[model samples]
Target: MGSGVGMGMGWMWLFWVLLILGVVLLAVVAVRAFGGGVTRSDRGDGRMSQERSRARQVLDERYARGEITTEEYRERLSALGEDR
Candidate 1:
C-alpha cells in the first residue's frame, strides 16, 4: 500500500508536466496556424494581397461547408473586398 501511494504521487507529477507541455505546444501551434505576424514580404511575391486572397479562399470553403451562414459569409467577404 505504501509503495503504491508513492507511485501515484509520481504519476501526479508526470501528469502536471504533460499538461504544461501540452499547453506550450498548443500555443505555438495556434500562433503558427493563425499566421502570427506573418507578412507578405516573407513571401517571395512582395505583394500582401495574396495573403488576403488565401484568407478569402478559406472563408469561401467554410461557407461552402455550411460552417458559416450566408449573411456572415457576405459580411466577411465584403470586409475582405471579395464582394460585389
Candidate 2:
C-alpha cells in the first residue's frame, strides 16, 4: 500500500510539471503571435540611434571644453549630419 501511494504521487507530480510547462509554452506562442517581441532590424535601428546620440554628446562636450574650435565643431557636426 505504501509503495502504491508513492508511485501514484510520483505520477501526480509529473502531471503537474507537464501542465506548468504547457502553460508556459502557450504563453510564449501567444506573445509571438501578438507581435510582442522585438525584431533584429528594430534592435539594430535603436542601437544605431543610440550610437549617433552618444557621438553627438561627445562632440558637444568637446566643443564646450574648447577641445575643438567652433569651425571644427561645425565641420564635424555637418559630417555627422547633426548640424543644429
Candidate 3:
C-alpha cells in the first residue's frame, strides 16, 4: 500500500509538471500571436524613420569627407534604395 501511494504521488507530480509546462507554452504562443513582442525594426514610434534619416545623414557626411568614393556612395545609396 505504501509503495502504491508513492507511485501514485510520483505520477501526480509528473502530471502537474506537464500541465504547467503546457500552460506556459500556450501563453507564449498566445503572446506571439497577439504581437506582444518587440520587432527588430520599426517599433511603430517613428523612431525607425528617424534612424534611417540619421543613417542617410551619416552616409552623406562620409561622402562629403571623401571617406567613400562616389561610386561606393552611389552603390551604397542604391543598396539603401534611396536612389529612387
Candidate 4:
C-alpha cells in the first residue's frame, strides 16, 4: 500500500518536467514564428530587389527602343509592382 505514495510522487515529477519542456518548446516556436533567430543571409541577399530592378531596367530600355507596346510594358511592370 505504501508503494502507491512513490507512484504519485513520480507522476508529479513527470508532470512538472513535461510542463517545463512544453514551455520551452512554445518559446522556441514563438521565436521562430516571429523571425527572431533568422538573419539577412537567409533571404538570399536582396535577390528579389535585384531581379525587380533588372526587369524594370529592361522594360525601360525596351520601351525606349519601341520594341514592346506601351500597354504590354505597363501591364508587365504593374504585375511586377515595379512601376513605382
Q: List the residue pairs that clash in candidate 2.
A: none
The predicted structure with the larger TM-score, 1 or 2, is: 2
lDDT of 2 by residue, 1-84 (tens): 455656677589889999999999999999988976777636855887788889999999999999999999999999999878
Tell me which of candidates 2 and 3 scores higher on TM-score: 2
Task: Report residue 40 deviation for candidate 4 (angstroms).
Answer: 8.4
lDDT of candidates 1 onward, in order: 0.85, 0.88, 0.85, 0.84
Which of candidates 3 and 4 reaches a greater lDDT?
Answer: 3
Candidate maximizing lDDT = 2
Task: Give per-residue CA lDDT, model 1, range 10-80, as digits (tens).
Answer: 57988999999999999988998887655656667655677887889899899999999999999999998
TM-score for each candidate, following the candidate numbering:
0.44, 0.48, 0.46, 0.46
Off by over 4 Å in 1: 1-44
Q: Name the weakest run of 10 consecutive residues (lDDT summed) in model 4.
A: 35-44
RMSD, each candidate, Å?
14.8, 6.2, 7.6, 6.8
After superposing candidate 4, which stretches have Cα over 4 Å from the reference? 1-42
